[model samples]
Target: MKKRSGAGLRARVGAIFVILAATVAVVDGCNGQNSIVGGACVTGYVACADQCVNTAVDPANCGSCDVVCPSGVACLDGLCGGPVDGSSDGSALGDGSSGDGSAGDGSFGDGGDGGCEPPFNRSSACGACDVVCVAPNSACLADPSGNFVCAPPCTPPLVECENACVDTQTDPLNCGVCGKFCPSNLCANGVCQGATPGDVVVLGHDYSSGAAGSSQAKVLTNAVFIPPSNPLRVLSYEQFADAAAVARVKSLVQSAAFGRTVVFTPSTTSADLASPTLAQSYDVVLVYDQQGGAPANLTTIGASWVTSLSDFAKAGGVIVALDGAAGQGGMPQLLTSAGLLAVGGHQTIPAGTPVAVVAPADRIGAVVASPYGVYNRSVSLQAVEPEGPNVIYVAKQLVNGTPANPVVVHKIVNP
Candidate 1:
C-alpha cells in the first residue's frame, strides 16, 4: 500500500467513525423483533432471554435471572419473601399495612398490636406485647370487669400455691397459708398437729344440780382441755338468742380462771364462714342461736359457707353449737346438709329435768357430772333419735325415774 494524503486519510476515518456510531445505536436499542441486537443492559438491570430486566425487584427474575418468587411472596433487595412496600407491581403478598394479614408490621393474624398475632390475648403475649403469663395454675383470662388479666386457674376454696391448686386447710406443705410448711407434716384444721391428745367442748344446754345454777366451770374444766403448748383460737358467731349467754361464754373463756389461752374473735355476720382461708384461721367455730331461738338459715348462709364449715370440721376443727343452734334451720341442718350427721334434729326438754350419764367410759361421759340437772330452757336431739357408729349418747333425761330421752349427745367425727 502507498502512503495516502492527509485530507484523503481524514475523510476515510470520519466515514468509519459514523459507521461505528450507527452500530452502537443498533446494540443499545431494542430490535423490531423485540430482542437486543447485542448484550447491552442498563446499570441496575440484567439481560435475560433477549430482554433487559431489573432482577433486584422483579419477582420472575429475583436475585438472579429466572429466579421467580412464590405467588404470595415479594422480591426485595434481590431476596424473595420480603415485606411488601405497596410500590411493588401488585404481585406480592399482603397490603403492606399494619393489619390485613401482612408481614410488614408483624400482623399475621387478627392483629391487635404489632409483633403479636391472634389479638395478643394469648398466655405467651397476654394483654400487651411481650407480657408472658406464668404457667401451671395461672392463665390469661378476662376478669369480671371485662379486662384481661393474669389470674390463678383455681376455684374459690382452692388457692394457687407452687403452681398448683391446693387446699390450705389440709395440705401439710401449705397449711393455713402458702409456703407455710409443717415440720411434722400433720396439718389438721389448718394447724400443725402435735402429739398431745385433743378434746371437743360442748357449750350447749345448761348443766345444773338443784340451786347450783349453770355448772359452766365444771363442764369447761372437764370437756374443754387445751394443752399449754397449743392455745385454743375460737371464732364465735355472736348471734345468740340471749346476749347474756354470749357474755357468759366470753367472760368464762377470757377470764384467767379458764386456765388456757383462748383467742376469741366475735363477728355478727357469717362472711368469714364462706372463706376457707378465713375459717381455717381458728381452731374452733361456735355457732350460737339467733334472737328467735332458731339458728341462722343455711339457705341464707349460702352453699359455699356450708361447705367451708363442713371442711373445717372434717379437717379437725371443733364446732360448739348452743341451745337453739340445732333447731329447724341451725347447725343440725348444716350438719345434715354437709353429710357430717346422717340424722340430726332437735326437741325441747322440760326444765329441772334429771339427766344421767349413760356411757361412763366415753370422753363426754367421763367429764359430764352424773345426775345432771337442767336449769334454763334446754333442747335435745333425743326425739329425732340421732344414730350412727360415731354417735355417743353421753347422758339422757330421766322422766319419772326412768331414762326417757338423750339429753347430752356427742358425735365423734374422725378427720
Candidate 2:
C-alpha cells in the first residue's frame, strides 16, 4: 500500500470525528436528553413537516403533529382542556399550579396533577370538593343565595335531627320537636306519653326490695309506668361479676308488672357496651353492682364505653345504674369523665331506712306513697350524691327521721 500524505490523513480523521459526533447526537436524542442528528429536533420536541414542535403546550399540534386544539380549550400536558382558573379564555391549563390544587379548600375543577376530579353535585362532594353531604337521604341543592348546599335529609312532615330524618309528630325520641325525647317512649300526635312533658320519672332501687308483694317492690313497679302498647327494649350488661346481683336484677325486671312492658335482652358484653350501634338498638341500659359490692370493672368501663353510654343517654336512651354501679369506676365516674356530672360518688344508707318522696307532684313521686321502707333486711341501699344540675332528686332515705341520701333520682340528658 502507498503511504498516505499528512493532508489526506488529517481530512480522514476530521471525517471520522464528524461521524462520531453524529453517532453521539443520535444516542443522546434517543435518550431524550439532547438534539437529534442534523439538529432537527431538541429534547421534548418532535419533528413535524420538517419543523420541530412542542406538542405538550402547542394548540396547533396538541398531543401529536397536526392535532389542533378546539376553541376555548388549552393544550395541557398533551391533552386539550378548558381553563381551571375560572377564565373563559382557557389560557391557563390549571389553577396556575403544577400540582394538586385542591389544598383542602373545597374547590372544584381540574387540578392538573392527575388527581381525582370531584363531581359537581355528588353526595361525596356536595357543593364543593370534599364537602360530603349526609348519605341515604340528603341531596345537593341550590340555596336562596344561588349557592350550592346540602339539603336536609328529611322531607315534608319530617325533620332532620342529629343527622337523622325523623317525623317529629310520631317519633318518640323526637316528640313534637327535635331533641325532645319522651321518657315513656310513647308519642301521640307529637305529644309525650305522660301528663307533663318535662316531668321527672324515677324507677328501680339500689338493691332487691324483698318479695314482689312488698310495699317497696310495689312502689318501684308502679314508678316505671311505661305503657304496655309501647314496650321498652332494655339491653342489660352481663359483666356484673356478682351472680346474686345479676339474679336480683333479673327478678326485678322479669316481675309480672315490669315484664309486661319491658323486653329484657341480657346479651351485652364488655365489648358490646362500647359499640354505639348496639347501644342505639335498646331504649335502656342497666348496669348493676359487681362482685363484693365493688364498682363496675375499670377494664370494662373504658373511654369508648363511657362515650357510648353518654351518647345513648343523649339520644333518648335511659341508663339505670344500681348500688355500686353508681360508685367510683362506675356510672358516676363515667358521667364525670364525660363532663355530664361535676361531682360523682355514692352514700351507703343503713338497711330498713325510711324513704320519703322529696319532689312530690313529680312523675316519680306521684307513683309511690311517702314514708316507704326497704323490705330487704340483709341488703343496704346506695345513694348517688352530688348530682349534676341536670339530675332531679325524686326520693331520699330518712335516717333517724332526717331526710338524707338520695335513694331515687331522675335525669333526662338532652345535650
| Top-scoring candidate (lDDT) | 1
TM-score (all chains, Cα) for each model: 0.46, 0.45
Error of 1 at 269 (Å): 1.1
- Clash totals in order: 0, 0
- Candidate 1 regions exceeding 4 Å error are 1-217, 220-229, 254-258, 293-299, 302-304, 325-335, 338-345, 383-385
List where candidate 2 sits over 4 angstroms from the true fold: 1-205, 213-215, 218-229, 256-261, 278-280, 292-296, 299-302, 324-344, 375-389
- For 1-415, candidate 2 gives per-residue lDDT tens digits of 6778897555444533432343233233323222121222424456666444556555667679999877644454456642333122221222334344221121222433221233435454444333445544356666687655666556778787766779978898777656556767888787666533221233334454366545455444444433222355666665643566567656765674433456677754667767766433565666654333233444335454667776665555556554433224244444344333333455444456688877776555565668777544222224344456567777777777887767666665664
RMSD of each: 26.1, 21.3
- Give the per-residue lDDT digits (tens) of candidate 1, residues 1-415: 6777897555444533432332232223222122222123334446677555545445677778899888744454456744333222211221233333222222112222232233535555454433445644147677687645556567768888756889988887777766554556888777766432223333336322123223323444334433222346677777434566667656655553345566677877768766675434766676555434333465355344666766666655666655442225365554454443433566666666677777778755665567776656565553343545667666677778877666555666555
C-alpha RMSD between model 1 and the true structure: 26.1
Enumerate residue pairs that collide in model 1.
none
